[model samples]
Target: MDSISIDEILGITRGELLQGERDLKIKNVKIDSRKIQNGDLYIPIIGEKNNGHEYIEQAFLNGGSVSLTQEKDRPFPEKMTVILVESTLEAMKALASFNRHRYQLPVIAITGSSGKTTTKDLVASVLAQKYTTLKTEGNFNNEYGIPQTLFNLGPEHEMAVIEMGMDHLGDISKSIRSVDPDIGVITNIGLCHIERLKTQENIFLAKKEILQTLKNDGMALVNGDDGFLKKLKEEKNSYQVQTFGINDQQSIKALEYVSNSSGLQMLVEWEGKKENYSFGFPGVHNVYNCLVAIWLGHFYKMTQPEIQKGLDAFVPSGNRMNIFSIGKIKVINDAYNANPDAMKASLDVLETVGADYGRRIAVLGDMLEMGDFGPAAHYEIGEYARKKADVLIGVGDLGKEICRGYGQNRNDVYHVANADAAGACLRKIIASEDIVLIKASRGMGLEKVLDYIEGGNK
Candidate 1:
């Protein structure tokens, strides 16, 4: 990390240091006092439960050389250097914004209702083929996360892939303005955070705020297969807009498909040329991610072979469509997070791959926070799951809706209260050659069932 010294941070400070050696230079700034290291500057942010300002003494003891805080009347630590600010959080954001302007790297910002993290990972991997790349780590795509990611950037990094997530109307714009991306990518808008935004159109509007802070020469890469994105044409003199998808008119497109339980194989269309590609990640949704990365690779002038190697190197981590075999049963563990669109996509994968296999089963949990649409959305999953799978097991309160949707016609439908119960029943019911899919929101911890079915205790 190319760190700036305490003198440099003081130069950006709103107020003066209270004590300690004037010439002492701290190498890094940390918000959490608990993680403070020697020669580190800690920002005391006021928050719920406890105030960070109250921990300045502990911070100094933990080797925090300097402190940034709003309280001026607090007892001064004997030799601790203090940099007073009007507000610690605002100052931290300001420092992050200032640091962002110091880098000449291409910052790629990705956002949507779903797949932001996966898509960010894919694009970063591809870009890494040509540059020294930095990417946002797991779930660090929010207000604090965005600034933490920016603060980690140094002179050596040539490019950055930032995943921006927002639930309310001004959130995306605020984060984008902070990062000021050179490339804005939208994976696809879907039903997420509807409790605040209300409708899909509102979600689209909130997501399109990525354009608000993009550089004039930046590009907006969108999913062309998305009906909403397909209808949007670029305005003259605005930032460049490009599309990637399997259908619709797009600068990048996917052609030739062969998807099985193992993974995906397809050809990508880019710049009037087409090339075959193979990916370890399964599902058509991931194919769209590949097309986006290939488009970005072409943008950075990577040769076809290098781009192909980069695509092949990408892999899904944790529980994002990670396929594994337990004895004779095949399990598709995609229980990281769930929504209507993602559930439908997973069902599509199961239907396409289960043609000649044994019984196909879908172990689904409630899709939470849909507001008035929660029950109906869960029902939709049951409706779709019944068509693609031989058995459907629904869990949680909303799982009742899923069970009701499947109705008496589907004799294999079973509803359970939690993952442990579902797992116990599933272990006895599944037979050899059975293909099962486990999916639900993060709170449901549906992976428990996946783990149990694969021999882990729930």
Candidate 2:
């Protein structure tokens, strides 16, 4: 595949290109100086621990033609190019903005306090049925990750699905402007980043920034069931808004939903047409994700059969609600990440599935970044887990609060320090016909429990 020429890249003006061979052209962009190639342009981003500006010489030795820097020091040979900028990170955003316009692809931007990753994955999978699609990789939805994802797009791609995440104000604005999207999707705003944002209303404002930089013809796909998002009405200049929901009336709705041991089945109502769809992913909440994907599938003109096939074939990556049978044990590995809403959802699912099984266990960890509400929120979670879960295994300080809430309700409840302890305990306590649900924040790394239970394989 052909590469983006250095000339076409943003923030590469004559003054910025200080002391480089005029004939030099970069084949690709590299933020890490260590991975700089012969014709690569290096951007030195100032991060928390180390500064990329410190490695200009190493980048030169690795064969980079240009290095972007805010540092005043002239580290390289006089002949080599140093792209000077007031802020290398801001310049990176500018570069990403230029690339977004250059490609002019139909972009779908997804943001929310919850379910952004799952919804993005579902939309990308359905879009792939009819379009050459590019999607966000992992949780790379921040300032640096947005630029990198945009630059990774090649000529072969027709649609881009970018997931935007934020912990504070203005993060989404930077992310949205970087990839001026034609379709904006807000999965649902919840209490995920309450530590930084302070209130759900503030979180809604942050996520709505995706619409601020939207292309003229862009459409906003919103969750009609969410009270905060539902309050946002259409203005004259407002992009055409579409809504999706399970019970609440919406543009696209899941009229009736059903789930069993195998998977989920739902009837989606769109434009007065009701279609029954079944997905491999199990959950009532996943039905909403399925609706969004189906809407996007319709937008891309995918046939009903292709959309159905795609939704049915969809499976979550990493640890989002993955079910495994270890010997005689049924383990629900939903350890990708967790919040109050998701934890409750998983507990409900466990309650439903565990009713038929012998025993139910909830192995949970701290839901971080909850600010002052952390302990109380965890306690509420513990109280609910006590009622729904037969055994509760807690990890970290926040989890200790959850265990405390369970109080003298004494069933099988234990608070451990880390995932290693949780994993070790699982090996001993977990047995035949037991159903276990493992969940925690991304930092908790509770997937280790899955590894331990699956014999380090699943």
Candidate 3:
């Protein structure tokens, strides 16, 4: 963060100075006092468990130059910059909004039920060819995280490809009101967050909030192939909507796509021109991600080679379809997060990629947040697992339903209680010429199975 005058912060956050020099320079902004550097601006947050106002003293003691406090009359040490605000969270947002206004560049905000991170990465990768891009890292797509991501924006950045994630209504709106994106991309609406959202319709409406936040002249590239999103023209009457898909009437379309164990090839048609690109990543969902990336790349006027290079360079983050070798065995560690769509896609990749190795082992787990649809979702993935995995080991209570769904593999399919059990099962089932896939929801900690297998603990 660039140095902002204490007076400037007071002006932006509508905060009044309680003590200390108004001319003091704040070179960094941090929430945690332990992470605070000398002259850093500490913004205290009021979270569910503990209030941050109590930590203000500790922050200043540990080299904080400035602090925002919701407590009107907290005892403070003299000579430190202290600012009083209605709410520290709101103050943080206000400060972030002010910081974002400093940049007059393309801010592409991406939101979806899934694939937002991958979409953001691919978009940034493509945009890097023509622009110095700033992107959202990891779970930094929320109100608190997006602002921190934006705070890194300086004079050098030409474009900001932001990922705005939401599990509820108005989450995207809050981020959009902060960053105000130039372009918005909606990957798809699905059952990922349906537990909180109640229905797919609600999830669609929640995801659609990104479009509502778009500028009047801004472009929104939606998945026309998505059954829910394809109806956006009728559901919302706002801006001129652009569509992209594999099999539909749209501005950008994938003319042809093919995938093997190695990678993927696609013929994309957009703006009356056809182009061919090869992707190092596999899975049909990534083809959609590529289409979105290509659209964003083309919109920014990047050459076909640049866009292709970016796509080729795009690697899956988190534990999503990450294919690598584990000694003599090949492994796909997709143990990050899972809904039905992501789980099925990973299973398909497991089936395809392990073909050369001959043996396929899938250590599956529960797909949480399905609500009343949990059983059916697990069943759907389980039924698919029967065809995909030569050996299927299901974990968790929901895994029982998955094992039940894959009835054909009664002998091969075994249900375990947790990652340790799954790892033990995998140790016995996996061999030198085998390909193994480990996948589950974020809560399940399925990566521990991979750790166990890789660590030679089993």
Candidate 4:
């Protein structure tokens, strides 16, 4: 990040410099004391279990030039600069906001229950064909992660694609307001956060917050296939609205698509032209993600060939639709995260891609944070998996519910207590050339099964 003077930071965050030269410039900002570098500003966050204020001395010892503290009377190293703020988190957000607005580049903010990361990557790839772009890394879409991403912005970046994820109301509002995106995209509304949100309507309302701080001339792109987002096309707003989906009625629609174990190819109708596009990822759900990227590329006046090059260059993040072979068997490791919607989509991929293989094996774990909807969601996913997988291994307590839904009478269905047990069962039943799908929520740690398979078991 570009260096900023202590005076500017104090002015932007309304922080008072407890000790330091106002003219000193900080070249970088960090939250973790272990990551502190020379001339870096350390902002200690107060989390539930750990207090960052306690790490101030360590940060300074590690070459931190400045630190933000909530404790006003706290003692620090003799020469270390300290700033007192009401809250370091808020101060970081303020500083991030200041850093973001320094550039007049277009910011594309994406938020949804699922596919936000993939959409961000695709959009950034397409934009990169014509401009130097920056995109969020991994699942860093939270309040803290958003600011950290914005801190990396420099004069060399021509655009940014930010992903926003939320569990409570106002989460997206805070992030969106900080970035003030030129274009907002909602991938879809689903039951991923139903525990905190309560209902689909409430989730939609929460996701819609991304548009609250959108520029007046901005454009909102949504998945027209989603019943909730489809209504957005009718809403009157300060910005223009565009719909993209496989449906015939969308503003940008995929006319026909085909997916196999190899990859996906589709015919899309955009801007009064129908063209064939192919990307090396196999999932029907990804069609929506590609459509969003395609629309954004065309909006920026990128040539069709440039857009296709971006599409061809795109790569799925690890553990999300990451296809590979373990010996003779094919493994679709979509264990990054899951909900009912995502689980069903992955099951579809398992079914379609595993068609030529020996057997379709689905080793699924719990879908956590469903609240009252947990049991039914797991059971329904089991029922959905019946036709997709020849053998089903369910992990965790809720995973047992899946086996029950898959039917106890069938010997092909097995319920295990954890990933290890699931791995053991998989080793016994999994044959050479069999296709397997491993999926669960982030909390489930279902990726262990993949590790177990690769760890000399295969």
**Each prediction's whole-model lDDT (CA):** 0.82, 0.82, 0.85, 0.90
Q: What are the per-residue Cα lDDT tens digits for candidate 3 across 1-458?
A: 56789888988888988888887888867887788889889988878887888888889889997899989888877867899988888888888878888878888889887788888899899888888989988888888888888777877899998898887887877777888877778999889988888999999888888877566688778999999888876655556677888886887898898888877899999999999998887789888888998988888888999999898778777787788987888989998889898888888888878778968988899998899999999988888998888888899999998898888447888889998989888887777878899999989999888866686674
Local lDDT at 179 for model 2:
86
In candidate 2, the residue pairs with backbone N, CA or C atoms under 3 Å apart (3 or more residues apart, or in different chains) clash, namely none
TM-score of each: 0.93, 0.93, 0.97, 0.98
Best by TM-score: 4
Best by lDDT: 4
Candidate 2, residue 91: Cα displacement in angstroms equals: 1.4
lDDT of 3 at 5: 90
> Can you list the residue pairs that collide in candidate 1?
none
Regions of model 1 farther than 4 Å from truth: 48-50, 234-237, 353-357
Query: Which runs in model 2 stand beyond 4 Å of their true positions?
Result: 1-15, 77-79, 234-237, 454-458
Local lDDT at 314 for model 3: 84
Q: Model 4, residue 37: displacement in angstroms?
A: 1.1
Summarize candidate 4's per-residue lDDT along 1-458 as a digit string, tens digits. Answer: 78999989889889888987777899988888999999999999999899999999999999997999888988888889888999899999999999999988999999998898889999999999999998999877999899989998998999999999999888888777788898899999999889988999999999999888765788899999999998987888888889999975888999999998777899999978998899888788889999999999998899889999999989888788888898998999988999898899899999888987999999999998899999999999989999899999999999988998898789999999998888888888888899999999888888888866776644
lDDT of 4: 0.90
lDDT of 2 by residue, 186-296 (tens): 988889989988999898998989899765677889998998877765456457888999766788999888876667888888889888888875667788788899988
In candidate 4, how many Å is residue 277 off? 0.4
Candidate 3 error regions (>4 Å): none
